[model samples]
Target: MTINIVVGAAIIRDGRLLAAQRAEPAELAGGWEFPGGKVDSGESDEDALVRECHEELGVKVALGDRVGGDWPLSAGSVLRVWTAGLVEGEPRALEHLELRWLGRDELGTVGWLPGDLPVVEAIAAYLG
Candidate 1:
């Protein structure tokens, strides 16, 4: 089986966590997620995270550490998450419908994509 590795970033600034709403791929539209994308071959997770953040959110980020355990995605893929800090540029909704910063108490209030739940929980704990 072919396995694909995807990465996600839990970008936090000033006590708020950034969440993005999906805008494409009919099935995932309107759902919330941490901004990131697939890890290219020969790329480190940190490099992938930074590239994805720039591509999807138009921001530069510094990856801190892993946020949660691996999550299985469709098509034999696994999603890995990390905690990130904004290093340059403000995050913009480049590929998403919307972007919002949620406080720790409001983390669970949004409709997160199913695969992102574990990372979300881990982020909540990290913030507390």
Candidate 2:
């Protein structure tokens, strides 16, 4: 089976990024990751991010830069991550067990999903 996961980094005004804790376990259980999920077939990347963000964080995003493109996870899952700004609604932990706003220095404090460490670095660079 092929698993295509599209993720997004909702960067807040304070230079912190948003991450969500997965509610299910296949891999990276209990670990934090960028807020996003699988992109439906024929769905645009940005569209997927928007939908996923609303579903997971209860917030609407004003799309920002494409910090980077998709990268393959060690689990063979592909992730499409984007950089977005908060537009409307406050971020609430909906699907996730918890949600956090993490600064670059604080990013390493969380137990991130397997492939998300690299993504953190990439996002940090993009933010700089």
Candidate 3:
């Protein structure tokens, strides 16, 4: 099976992390996630994170360090996460149901997608 690499962005500002609510793919609907998407062929993870944030959140983000190691996704795909800072424009829910900023104390309150849980933990640890 071919492996697809997906990138997720943990965009932080004012000591809060941006969380997006998924609105599609029925199964993932209403699940919270860091804004990002699949990396295209020949595209670097950083490039893909930037592109995905633009496409999904209507914002430009400056990427920071990688978060946790790769987490597995359905269909032979792996999900990788990175920390990011907003560089231009505010994040709008261009593709999601809603967007919320969660403080380190509130991170555990949202219903994160299963594939995102590990990344969430990593972010929580990084923020502490």
Candidate 4:
């Protein structure tokens, strides 16, 4: 089986990370996750990330340093997580049902998609 590759973004501002809730349950449904989506055909991971950010959050992201990346679970899907700062545009939830800023303390408060837990830990490690 061909594993799906996804590019996820961890937008940090004022020490808080931006997370979005999936509209419904599927793999990580109802769980809070980084705002991103699968990389489309003919699109590089970086390009896909930029597009996903604009399409999902309505914000322009300057792909900062890559903080973390991994292929967790048996789906063979790879998760590329990056540290990005908002270049322009205010965040308006485009596809996600809701969005919120989560501080380190509140990070564990929300329900995270199973695959996201490792990504979250990586982010937490990078922040500190």
Candidate 5:
């Protein structure tokens, strides 16, 4: 079985979390998710995450804590997430349909993609 590795960022600023809305894949479109992508072969997860942030959000991020253990996803892929702080530039939804900052109490206003929902719980606790 081929296991795919995916990484995500829980970017927070001023006690607000950044959420990106998906713009592709008919099944996942319109869903909210953290802005990161696949870990390319030969690239460290950290490097992929940083590169993804720059590409997806047009910003640079300094990764902090890991959100949790590897999160299981459909098929054999697993998602690894980390808490991130913006190092430079404002977030832009370059690869997403939209970007929104949700405060501690507003995390549930948008429908999060299922694979990303568990991480949200961890984040909500941190936010509180």
Candidate 6:
């Protein structure tokens, strides 16, 4: 079976990670997640990530090291994450209900979408 791929940006600055709150798709709404979206056909993962960042957050990012291996999501998709630093523009919650920068100690303060919780933990381990 062909797996669907979703790309996420773990945009970190000043020891905090950027998280976006879902605004639609009621079931997932209000839950926090890293900013990103699904990859389009023929798009490279990195290109999709950059495009998603621009479309969702109105910002440009310089990708750093990847976070971990493919993280399983519901259905037949996987989430791939990369560390990112802002190369241009500040992030705005264009496609999200809200945006937050959570410090390492504050990671658990918000309710994360199920698929994002593990990635959040992985981020915390390195933020130390």
Tell me the tens digit of each residue's lDDT in model 6 across 1-128. 88999999999998899989999899999999989989999999999999999999999999998999999898899999999999999999899999999999999999998998999999996574
What is the model-wide C-alpha lDDT for candidate 4?
0.83
Candidates ranked, most accurate by lDDT first: 5, 6, 3, 1, 4, 2
**Model 4 agreement with the true structure over 52-87: per-residue lDDT tens digits:** 999999999988777555647446787888888899
Q: What is the C-alpha lDDT profile of model 5 across 72-112, one tens digit per residue? A: 88899999999999999999989899999999899999999
The TM-score obtained by model 1 is 0.94
Return the TM-score for candidate 3, rounded to 2 decimals. 0.95
Model 2 RMSD in Å is 2.2
lDDT of 2 by residue, 1-128 (tens): 87767666655557788878877775666888888887889998888889988888888887777756667875767777778888898989888889888777787888888777778888776442
In order of appearance, the predictions have TM-scores of 0.94, 0.86, 0.95, 0.89, 0.97, 0.97
Worst lDDT window (10 residues) for model 4? 66-75
Per residue, candidate 3 scores C-alpha lDDT tens digits across 45-86 of 899999999999888899999986889878789999988999
Stretches off by above 4 angstroms in model 6 are none
**Candidate 6 lDDT:** 0.93
RMSD of model 3 against the true structure: 1.1
Count of backbone collisions in candidate 3: 0
- Which clashing pairs does model 6 show? none
Question: What RMSD, rounded to one decimal, does every model reach?
Answer: 1.1, 2.2, 1.1, 1.8, 0.8, 0.8
lDDT of 3: 0.91
lDDT of each: 0.90, 0.78, 0.91, 0.83, 0.94, 0.93
lDDT measured at residue 50 in model 1 versus the true structure, 0 to 100: 94
Candidate 4: residue 121 Cα off by (Å): 1.1
What TM-score does candidate 2 reach?
0.86
Ten-residue region with minimum lDDT total, candidate 3: 119-128
Candidate 3 ranges beyond 4 A from true positions: none
